[model samples]
Target chain A: MSSATLEIVEPGLLTTVQDAGRYGYQRFGVPVSGAIDVFALKAANILAGNAQDAAGLEMTVVGPRVRFLADTWIALTGADLGPLLDDRPIPMWESVAVPAGAILSFDGARDGVFGYLAVTGGIDVPVVMGSRSTYVKGAIGGHLGRALMASDSLPTMERDGHPDPTNNRLPDHLGAPRYGNTHEIRVVLGPQDAAFTAEAVQTLLGSEYSVSIQSDRMGYRLEGPVIQHRSGPDLISDGTPLGAVQVPGDGQPIILLSDRGTTGGYAKIATVISSDIGTLGQAMPVDTIRFATVSVEEAHAILREREQVLRDIEKAVRGAAAEAVSIRIDGDAFEAVDDSGRLVSAPAVEGRVESEATRHARVTVDGRTFEFDVEVQRAD
Target chain B: MREDLRFLPAGDQAVVVELGDTIDPQTNRRVHGLMDAIEREEVPGVFDLVPTYRSILVYYDPMLTSLPELQARVSELYRDLEDHAVATPRTVEIPTLYGGEYGPDLEFVAEHAGLTPQEVIDIHSGTDYLVYMMGFSPGFPYLGGLSERLATPRLDTPRLEIPAGSVGIAESQTGVYPVASPGGWRLVGRSPVRMFDAEAEPPSRLAAGDYVRFVPIASETEYLKLQESAVKGIHAGDAAQ
Candidate 1:
């Protein structure tokens, strides 16, 4: 049986359909709701043979219990959420097949904070304002504009002929993921760096900040040394970037995230570099983090190196053995059965339903076409 | 006295051009003007440009253009700032239902202003407003102009949730909540207009430099009907003036 749907048995701590992010909408105050650790999201998507920005599940802390109704390839990355298929421990950072009716479950995280699960063909949801990312605050985008609820079923896109993505793994040279209790987050000095006294800047650099319980997707509140300001920690409201360390009057630093407000009035003494934002995102409450300053050139070099690493992973995955069991159809081609058959639904393509006959079904499997007899049951 | 423009590095990818240290009409307008010039010239590698009260943040792809090159290019553009003509802002009149349930803190605002709710309505609606920028919530305008008399501080303890379209004042600024969310602004009215719609083209009803006029409405039933239409994209009384 070719399963094309994922039924949610448990929604985990907080699971949302996220992609690269909702871009170009920040001008109107739309938060860019993407994966906390985009590196993991990209890796998972690459392993699943989907576009790098394809919508995937971003699970926080714990992972979800999912049962597939179709054969699909999947890759898990980021935090080590102990995922098991049919009670068997599976490998992370590799594309693997999930047969129809296979139960995938996970216990609490063994390593990281946010785990990304990318399925072959990606999670198909209506693209709202140019993204599938879930910004729960505005009740916009992703699955029903909120976190995944129990018993909710997510749809996967249909794919055409291709080598099964299960023929992929994170090459050894790419290096294993790092999930440590403490992180040294690199930052670039700010647009309002002058607002803080030299002593405050030193205090920030010299002190260790722990992630506070008040942290969320919007911002990470760090509790530590009081970052004394020149006057007050207030600036005319201005556009805030991801990882901006906005210091309010309380002097505690708040590292803004992907879901941060478009503009902020608090003065940000410094901004965390893009590459370290993922590392910062994985810092759970009570996790220790210390600030380190890096030149912009160094930051760019780090980002470029990370990109090269992903490229190498993709190149290596191309040569691995196939381990996937899911059936996939091309976007241009799809499995067609009687409307009354067991497969209750699929992504609708208008005027694609050719006939009214309920006796036959045609499906494409592993690049070839096959037909099956169907017995339709009409509603009373 | 006007201050010279200063460029500040946000990160490797973004640079902020500070028009001034304070939020004034001319400084804010200059910020928006630079945004227009950047957009018109199609600054290479720029993926997003955000115009704020006194600064414009240009987020670019550093791989395509370096910060120094972009800054030099922007500096050249700023040299022509005095010659550039400002675009005429589009005016959208927001129909506000002041006092009573729509504004939970109406009395507080009136008492602070030393006026009746009716006078507060007159003063609030009488002046046209400038949208400093969009932030806080989707399509929520950070308006610059507010009547000094009507200025009220935020509630000592903010409500857990403020309904969408609740027009509030904080210090010398006034704005509406585009979506139902937790906020700390002092509410004095509610606008029936939907400030944001995910399905609409250009989601935010108001953009930076846009003009807003708060027109008062009486009936709650009428307000609800207009809100439904606003959600569907027809703002009952709004048109570019």
Candidate 2:
């Protein structure tokens, strides 16, 4: 089996390989580094016929310009970075097949802060501590434990025949997270909320907070209403979960993310719900965020709902692969015949099949019917 | 079960089991004790257990276990925590080179503490400090048991980058920076020990509930030799105990 290589032409602003996350080591002060917008990364992986946790390139603000060394399928998701294939605009959140030497580039972020690009077999980086996610602070995991640079070559794992790329996309209306300048982020009042004044809690939930300029992958420092603490902003340092809204002595809340320190000393008044963290991942500096309260049960329900959306996307991609049969004879359209020699209308099938086939072929009929013999005959 | 133990929700996936309010040895022991019990029980869906000063944050998957269920399980584990002994804490000796270039802020800290540089060094290295928790950065221990005589205020203006292994003091706290980062702590010495190695098993050299002792060396030559050995992948903590 031949492995493909992805060569970087330009490193853009910041791009690194990430996956689900590095876990089970937070106890030792290791941050669970992964793609910030997990939903987008998972969706990109699903569209590219890879596992949800497959390592992929996570681009921030701007995206890297890369050239594929071999023919492969890829999907772009998350922030709209104006991705282009060989100088032509390509669709986002959908799988696209690229021939060998095809160049993929981006024109900076148009909608959000982070974007994800997932390929067929995922980025073939050595898994460090059971994950390929990059923890830049520790200088561990991913491609050399750092962001991608120009002239760097990334290996791609070898896989069996590719999944049918057509119709493998997440529709925008189907619970896909939306990115904008202002977002309403939901939070659950935290383990340290009692340390803050009641007015501070109201201040967090009532006012708008803008992402500070000092924000990075570690966390977003927000500037907004001062969340006054009852006594002081210090606490017996405790474990900081992902999306922990910790306020320092200055009373400014910092929403910790994937690369956050495992433990922190500030009093965290609330924690952003897991379902809404992806939205924070897409927020740019100065982007305003209004906080809303949610019960833990409600947060779990939201997470389940988001998970169900992913499941639906996976089902749709698989269903499309099973139901559609793209039959192309020298780029000419041909009518497909069923097992009983009946002309069956194929609505799901799209794109040209790059194969020479004249013999027997099995295809799904009406989404429920079993294998039907598809006779690929010339229209002439 | 301790009457002060409070189970607080940290988002939807984690619970902060507060054993007590203060950062004392007894409270920290309970934190680790409960963590050990929970780990031994192998409760389903529990992924990571972080023992801090007086709390253990239990990270779990909401899909496999709900907050109430996890809280209940942890409560049960806490009830029986006193029956099981917490693991014996290890004392990792960190060899240090104090004063001069290795410790740029030594004179300042000495002046702040109203003691000579040697006296500050002697007091700082004399005690076996308890590793209360690891935080801020990887393998960076939050040590307790600092001598009040050696206590000094943090630098009013934090240095942009404090080199890794720089031993520093601030107010009532004293610890070493495991990595190069901007910090306000007043540096008194530098260690030749590598506190964190990402590629090594149990990456952090020190863990919560452990003890750390600073052994001061006389010369820069000795410091360089130890630093070279550390670079060669020799585990300093392994041999120094």
Candidate 3:
């Protein structure tokens, strides 16, 4: 089958193409600029069997109406959008086989603030600076480095095969990613914690604040008690990291997000844990926010557990698919070629009949070429 | 006093050291030396090395290394770094057109310095400034070592956007805004020279370890001609100067 196309009917409140993030250029003062709810974006892609970092539509508050130009497999996740297929209700958190020229319209979101749409084989957008994420401030990546507009056409790559309509289901609780709007976002006390008054620290965690209307991908300008810095001068600019809660002289806490400037002068009082950053990003304006403190060890344990869960899910998926075949290369060394034209030498594998499921193979030095049916196991 | 520097965990694997309240030249030099040492040792887990006026933030990976291990390595290098000599620095020359439309706020800065516009330019261009760091925007340098007489406060309110290549002074510090950004610094002059080029390998003409000296030119006609040739990618005339 040929590639599919999706013609946007009504562009939502805020819809943009997003990928993983921009990296490795922080030293030059460039922001990462990527998807706000990274966890949700990743899960949506994996559920659709797309690349982990594939570009997808990030719809916030309101989602767009799209009409498919060809048959494709797609999944809608993150927020609970009251979606209607030809005026008929369609459930969230499940794969849906879109027929040729079918209209997919999602109205106002009821649960979370952001929703994601992931198509199998992913959205095809030109990558800039190694990412397809839109950096609105710099106008760098994504689809022409801007938001999708009405009547814009997006092309989809070939799918693994349309997901069976019967298999279109997701966990009930996971239908819409839950948001405890008042949950204390766990954070590690910052290097500049001592620079603020003890009362300031107490006020930060104990009190509740509202996400201001000024919030965007750059940072969230929180409205609450003024966080005062006791004895720091106009600091010579320094590098700012993701989730850094910086308090400028004005006293309001601005939580820096994915597209925050690489360096800043304001004193950062706290840094939100990586696990909770996604929660903060999904919070809507006027949503109440509290703070909690977690030790470095606890954060690591949480991360490890999350990774394990992902690995388990992948394993389950792999078991349901075809089994891997093993092959061994003889005396000659095999050469591994990457997109960058650089080559690394590996042990040669013996030629063997490729399994029907094997699209690629890992050749071992002891004369064996392991069929590509196996999932990649990373050291981490 | 020989108290051990307290190393605090930032997040997953990053460590941040807060070297409390001192902007003395000696402290700044120590910060630079420590960064050089950490780079030389090549600690495996550490991915990014960021040094500021007082603190040094090191970002690392928890999977490959632990926080305590990275802290121990930093402590070891800190002790070893005390004996190293100052590394040779590169000097960057910025060609600027002082006063007139190119530097509309030049008169204001001159008045703040208690001198005529010509005398203010003389004192400002006389001293060499070090590039402390690159931040705010790409290739924008935060330079230190300004003459006390040339100190000027920023505008009462910031401008919505300032043009790129505009050089300004705020209090005792001076900097060049490499890209057009919202700023409040008291502008003194604008440079026809391009401080940043996205096409260039290094992208920035100046980096954290370099030094800078401003050279003032006369007349807008000369400035425009120089700018046109520079945009066409010329570098010959200034090198001869």
**Which candidate has the top score in TM-score?**
1
Candidate 1's residue-wise lDDT over B39-139, tens digit each?
89887778888888888878887655688788888988887866348676788888899888998788888888889988888999999999988887788
> In candidate 2, which residue pairs get closer than 3 Å at backbone N, Cα or C atoms, i.e. clash?
none
Cα-based lDDT at residue A25, candidate 1: 79
Ten contiguous residues with the weakest lDDT in model 2 chain A: A362-371
Q: lDDT for every model?
A: 0.81, 0.83, 0.71
Q: In candidate 3, what are the lDDT values of residues A1-380, reduced to their tens digit?
A: 34448888898887888876876555556567888877777666756666557788888888889888877767777776677776677766666777887888876777767788887678887766667788776666776667888988888666545233334444333334577566568888885687799999999988899999999888988999988788862465666777888998888899988888877887788888777888898788898999988887787777666654443433333343313323233323334432333332354332233332333444331111123443223223
- Give the 10-residue window scoring lowest on summed lDDT in candidate 1 chain A: A321-330
Clashes of each: 10, 0, 11
The residue-by-residue lDDT of candidate 2 on A1-380, one tens digit each, is 34547899999999999998999888778889999999899899888888788899999888899999988889999999989999999988888998889999987678998899999888998888889999987888999989889989888886545555566877556745569899999999987899999999999999998999999999999998789999999887899988999999999999999999999889999999888999988888999999999999999999888877776777677765534444333343444544344545453332344454444433333212223344454444
Chain A TM-score values, per prediction: 0.82, 0.83, 0.81
| Cα TM-score of candidate 2 | 0.85
C-alpha displacement of A126 in model 1, angstroms? 1.2
Q: For model 3, what is the C-alpha lDDT against the true structure? A: 0.71
